[model samples]
Target chain A: MKLKAPECVFSSAGFCPGCGHGLASRLVGETAEELNIVEKLVTVVDVACCSFNIDYWNFDTIMAAHGRDIPTAVGVKHVRPGCPVLAYMGDGAAYSIGMAETIHAALRNDPVTVIVINNSVFGMTGGQMAPTTLPGERTATSPKGKDPARYGTLSGVELLKGMDIAYLARAELVGVGGMAKAKRYIKKALEHQLNGDGFSLVELLSPCPTNLNLPPVKAKQFVHEEMTKYFPLGEFIDKGGDK
Target chain B: MSKVKLNIARCKGCGYCVDECPKQAISFTGRISEKGYDTIQVDDEKCIACGSCYRVCPDSVFEILV
Candidate 1:
């Protein structure tokens, strides 16, 4: 099947080599275009490498402070209830700094789509250890490898497991099959918002080759082998039209 | 048959297309581009236009024409 390039991403992204942010952003752009919501789409980006997407996406984009993207997205949704609001953030911003905002939004069933790119490290800040960093993973902050005893890993999806979320899923962007699955999760998350079904979150496991201190090919392999071992891929919750 | 095209200049030498290619049709040309990254070359005879490279590439370097 021939897939059309997403025109919404008009310019090339400035992410690192083999970084998953580009692919994740492209999937969101493509989904917004496919759903015909490009005109009514408002994206709130957190202060991370993902925020650079503002330069590429051709939508009403807002840059929010670190960990404040969810609240900003809530405000946008309130002002423009008819528009589909998407909050794009990284693991550090979403899970560490904005953890409370993320949970409360899900608890209240806020009508917004939250796209979290979990690359296990803070890409923009030179690969610091993030809340989603896997145990034993080595980062700049944890040069000796992550210590599960002190710096434990947290699962955002698991935190909202029993909540009444419209949709919650995690997918890896390592290979073509995984990329296809991530695209489906992203589209489903946006569909929930367009349908006014309440809160949705799609966490994508991506690679940070530069931060991971590995070549792009090896970083992709790391995501498929090591990262997925801790953050499994699949739909954790899907209260959408199909179900 | 479907074909693959690469914008070598935009390539970051990630080799994602090489790893994802089921036919092992993509390989680095050992020549660096102006951007200081190794460029990839496609073996047309082995490629099946599966678009696997197009899908996994973050740089938007590959175009699969059907």
Candidate 2:
């Protein structure tokens, strides 16, 4: 069967060719559609590469300040307790600028779905070093590659693994099988929110071909071969008890 | 037999689909797309309709007609 593209997504995503934000955004849209919550979904996106989702997605969206998406999403959830809230952001916003908000939201057990796209660089700002940038990975800011001694890499999922959040997982878009698993993880994250469970986060290891200075295909392979080694995939925590 | 439909107008020509296709049925067209990137074409005879192209494409360029 030919799966229809999610209606919540626009044809022109405004993302560069081979950028993973488009695919990640589409996965959220597809998950919302599958859950029949498209109309009631309220998305709070950070002011980074994830800002593209504010336009690409046809649902009710709010563009939050950089690294402030989680708090904004928490606020939205408080106002519309019935509506499911989704926070979309990149590695810089989630781990660098927004680390405090991200941790506290989990600490407070807020009911919202957070999707962090871990591309290992600041994509919108021309691929600067990010908290998730792998060691020895060269970025614009780290010309000689990231020094693990000076700036250690941080895994968003690993940081949150000890938290009492409802769900925590890392997924990648490396191949068809990986994409399927990514979708499944995203669906589970959203479902946790639908059940009024507190705080679900799915960190997606996505490719950045333009920023990574590699072909679109090679960028994908990098995520599989290189990124996965630092940030493993699989459900770190699952309190949903199987759907 | 199945087919993969292309939306040339929306294609950004990242070539992810071309490289990811297990059957190697897709190739880059010399012509550029409306978005000014090199677009791709699929050889119908070689396509197995595994839907690999549909999953990997950043843009929603491919639709599998099974």
Candidate 3:
């Protein structure tokens, strides 16, 4: 019998060497496998890097429009009921353009699993500034650092906390241990959805060295400074009460 | 002891392993990978094989064989 590998593009078990999204995606994938959601699940991916790995992912997957992932996923759950649905998207797509769909999904208690890759920058699109980009932090568009007075506020984890979310957790994909821990949280989120509790999201603060114009190690440090300052860490809500 | 190995030819230089390493051992030589971008390299003695690199890599460059 030939053994198949875990799904996703960076199949070598190595990340982008500098990108943090790989760890976040794999954590979700591995957690999905460990929790036995692979066969019964279909992922709805967006235009970010994960879009490329949709083909390589070891599960049924679908591509949603840039900002339409949540509604597409919620629709999937409404039709199938038992199938596990995931709306995996980048920070810009999720917190910015896709905010309305995400809010309504949670408001209606949609059971689709959502994982937002909050790497601060619109990593896939030339690192343009994103709503989640911390105030006064630099990006391609915000090269001089984000200006709160000019750009408005930046917050995702807090925004989710305001909704009737079931299981909302935020973790950093900084290092090996942190990455593994983050994966475990993703597994738990899927478990919650499998139980039909409601909206579940894992806000992952990851590194983007290329966009940050920093080395990988230094990128990790930037994640510590920039990502954590806004995203924070740990479980923000558990309406299910058990987990 | 077992360790992880990387393939430079197939590497797309996504940098998933660089920050995924528990010991913080992975790095780039600043030379372009076959697919472009500086490539990822790991220090064998430093990797603990928590499989973090394997878990998050979009490029799939890690090989953990004993």
Q: Score the docking of each candidate (DockQ).
A: 0.70, 0.74, 0.33
> Which of the CAPRI classes, incorrect, acceptable, medium or high, describes model 2?
medium
Weakest lDDT window of 10 consecutive positions for candidate 1 chain B: B1-10
What clash pairs does model 2 have? none
What is the docking quality class of candidate 3? acceptable
As for candidate 3, its interface RMSD to one decimal place is 5.6
Error of 3 at A240 (Å): 2.3
User: After best superposition, candidate 2 residue B18: deviation in angstroms?
Assistant: 1.3
| Cα shift from native, residue A124, model 3 (Å) | 2.3
For candidate 1, the per-residue lDDT at B62 reads 76
User: Candidate 1: lDDT of A238?
Assistant: 85
Chain B TM-score against the true chain B, candidate 2: 0.91
Among all candidates shown, the one with the greatest TM-score? 2
Candidate 2 docks with a DockQ of 0.74
The parts of candidate 2 lying over 4 Å away from their true place are none
TM-score of chain B of each: 0.93, 0.91, 0.78
Go through the candidates in order and give each one's C-alpha lDDT. 0.88, 0.89, 0.74
Error of 1 at A158 (Å): 0.7
lDDT of 2 by residue, B1-66 (tens): 548787778888888888888889999888976679988999999998888888887788888888
TM-score of 1: 0.96
